[model samples]
Target: MQECSPPAQVAGRTPEKALLSPSRARYGEGMSRIDRPALGILLICAGVTAISVNDFQIKLLSGGYPLHQIVFIRSAIGLALTLVLLRFEGGFAALRTATPGLHLLRGLFVVAANMTFYAAVAVLPLAQATALFFVAPLFITLLSIPFLGERVGPVRLFAVVAGFAGVLLMQVPEAEGAGTVSPGVLLLPVAAAFLYASMQVLTRKLGAQASAAALAIYIQTTFLIVSALFFLVAGDGRFAEHTTNDSLRFLLRAWHWPTPEDWPLFLGIGAVAGVIGYCLSAAYRLANASIIAPFEYLGLPLAILWGWLVFGEWPSVLTWAGSALIVGAGLVVFFREGARPRPNRAARR
Candidate 1:
């Protein structure tokens, strides 16, 4: 799934290549012809909505199906959709790349991150899991220091520290009720976010070396392989028994044949994933990352809405407080980065 932010720009490129080359350019000529900021905002909103719906469907299926089985089916369908789109763009030629190792490493991170997040959402409230996932931007900031050689000033450093504090607050028990959350469960999404941030860092590293389509194909292929292995190992006799732990059961549950009535829902997930992935890439292409990145927080409210409508869950007081700090800290990093000066055209070459 496309996450909250676009990868940072690739380092060291000529001005002409940056503006004219399809792989190097932020958006193609068609997208550049429009009002970029406005179009970007709209696309980001649509992308966020599509992904939220996808998560809702995944959460619904998680109750009855094994996590790996669901990923296999969803990703297999999604890969078919991606291939159809790829044919229009340039067939298999568009997927050609020299950085196969980097792509595979990035794909591994994607698989780990998606599996962890799926496990988290299977047991936790959607809003709560999503809120914790927002800390990814903070993780990205820290990872960039070493992986991308980006410098962090004091203000952004403070944001990182405060953002983590928000994570801690989220785990605290409320005054009126006994905490229903298992402490171990909270770690799932946190680890997912860190892995996701690491994946984004790798995305930045490979942004110039590969097209977005190519990167996506690599990740989906990894998903297919990993999920299939899980299915082969656990889908047969293993599912004959049941586990009491919701998270463990979600992870290890055996694949059963989907009922005839439920086929459309499973297929629809692939379609949703396709749209979400496209819009996110398109959004970044159309406008500056700073302009569109903050809108990603829209996921939180959408999660709350779906949680209430579908599962009758609401955010607790601590959830609200924690979300505020997390969102505020993310905005701080975005704006600070936006305000920094960029190298001149001549310097870029």
Candidate 2:
């Protein structure tokens, strides 16, 4: 499936739930097999780790390189890896989309969402930025109603309300909290969450034409084009001297030639992006979303650990309180949805 909507991390869903065709709800995807669920958990654990490391390195490199430059290099490598992985799904033909316009629109929304979230990451503590971003589950829960014609029961409705309260709680951290960013800047992650959730909803309109690898290829291509455009317009770094804001600086700063020492980080994240997408794509296909969804919450703790280890940042009391609410609400929803009965692969076809 999609990366929690690429390996970026989702608020409340397994990557499979977010990216799978809206018409197909395989709550029991691989349940017939005993080993499958364990494998899925292991794959998600690996995926979360890759995403954490990737995010840490991106934040590390932000001070030295423009966001678009890093995106360009990362996407360039990831695109190649996705192309090779396409073989498993049915080759390049899987990319054939009857709804090109929908694909284009989705790719652009994903690009915008990533830009804002990373912008937040460059300035805020990784744990705080990620915790706030997990609000996407709230957004998706609401969006699915009108968009996918799905009904939200009173239980899920209550969960959405609580998850939203979590967002409000995080808005005012303790005085000693290190996760604080400018109030205006804090909105970036929320905005990204909205866009990411909206992208998932919009995908329902796309029909079941493209495979996960093919969809990833479209997104990487979008990243490549958008980053290239950023370079052509601002590679000179002339515009960067105007601001001292780290997030702005990260976004508009001039590109630089890669140093030998940093080359490995740049190349390595891209490779990891490819493998994460390919392997997790299969992992979800072989597992159930309900069982997998709770584990996906591991991303939050992983974010907290990375923030502490790499940047010496710690979550405030409010951050913890808010995360608990959001995560708890998401689990309720996932468990309920998972318990619902559904037909097997034959019925889906």
Candidate 3:
């Protein structure tokens, strides 16, 4: 667990220092043993909180706007922000790729992941949706074996199993209270998690040829376009008489646009979410996937808190216990990975 020095990515750079701070650059020296990881964890926590608030807002907004409409708005804003950040690196040309096939598939997966997960959120509690999405780590663990050609140890396998068991624990209580959970509804997060895991793997492959920011911009732009199209079609009666079954309708019908009075909340979401995305990209650049992967569980507690405070949706005691186990399993995997040797410097970035 020796701290390595930050690579040339930050060397002699003023903006880098201002953005990540000098202490962050010193993460490699192991001098400040606790700082880097703590920061990484804190960033993860903040990212999750921002994301939960975003989800909650989307949920409330769903009642007023169509899911596609809301996604279109958010993605449009997100993509605009991403493009502005990418201007320094390169413009749209920087995001161009030789692998158009992968880009197409990646976009499809990204949109599908959003649609499915949002649909799930429209039906299930925020905590439940968040808990089920935890399966993405397990999916990542398994996918890495064949895709990344990484070996999966028995302990990691056990962690994955324990994670799934936690999922069952969360679900069983809901089933008992509200009859059987439909496979379609319950499995949306599972499918989205798997798709997201696949997206992560794809990003690793794409990471070498293209900058992460460029890739992110491309994906968000893709989603924005697709979402706009879907929203238009839905509004035009492409689906079943534009029923409320679609996610976009759920949001649009729920809440009116936040006026000047609600600008604080809107700005809070935009600023926090924009920064979270930036921090997550920076973290992925600084460290290996394993080191940052487990920290994603920080979202669970944040989601639970937000759910209770805003929506008054208290999770059952059983869910609380299950969430604990899942978090524990994620931590075990994260800590185990941290203890292992990191790849060489040249290969990490």
- TM-score per prediction, in order, is 0.87, 0.84, 0.76
Q: Give all candidate RMSDs, comma-separated.
A: 3.9, 4.7, 7.9
Q: What lDDT would each prediction earn against the true structure?
A: 0.72, 0.71, 0.58
Ranking by TM-score: 1, 2, 3
Off by over 4 Å in 1: 1-35, 175-178, 237-243, 344-349
Candidate 3, superposed: residue stretches over 4 Å from native: 1-43, 90-93, 173-181, 205-208, 237-273, 341-346
Which is the winner by lDDT between candidate 1 and candidate 3?
1
lDDT of predicted model 1: 0.72
Each model's number of backbone clashes?
0, 1, 22
RMSD of 1: 3.9
Model 2 steric clash total: 1
- In terms of lDDT, which candidate is stronger, 2 or 3? 2
Q: What tens digits encode model 1's per-residue C-alpha lDDT throughout 1-349?
A: 3433222222221234334445443324321333377887898888888778888898988877888887788878877877777776567887776568877887788788888887888888888888888888888889888877788899999999998988888887771111765787887878888888887777665453434455557777888899888878887637536667677788888789988877877998878766666567666655666667788888889988999999998888888888788888888988887676665222211
Residue runs of model 2 more than 4 Å from their true location after superposition: 1-39, 173-180, 341-349
Looking at model 2, report the run of 10 residues with the lowest lDDT sum: 5-14
Top TM-score hit: 1
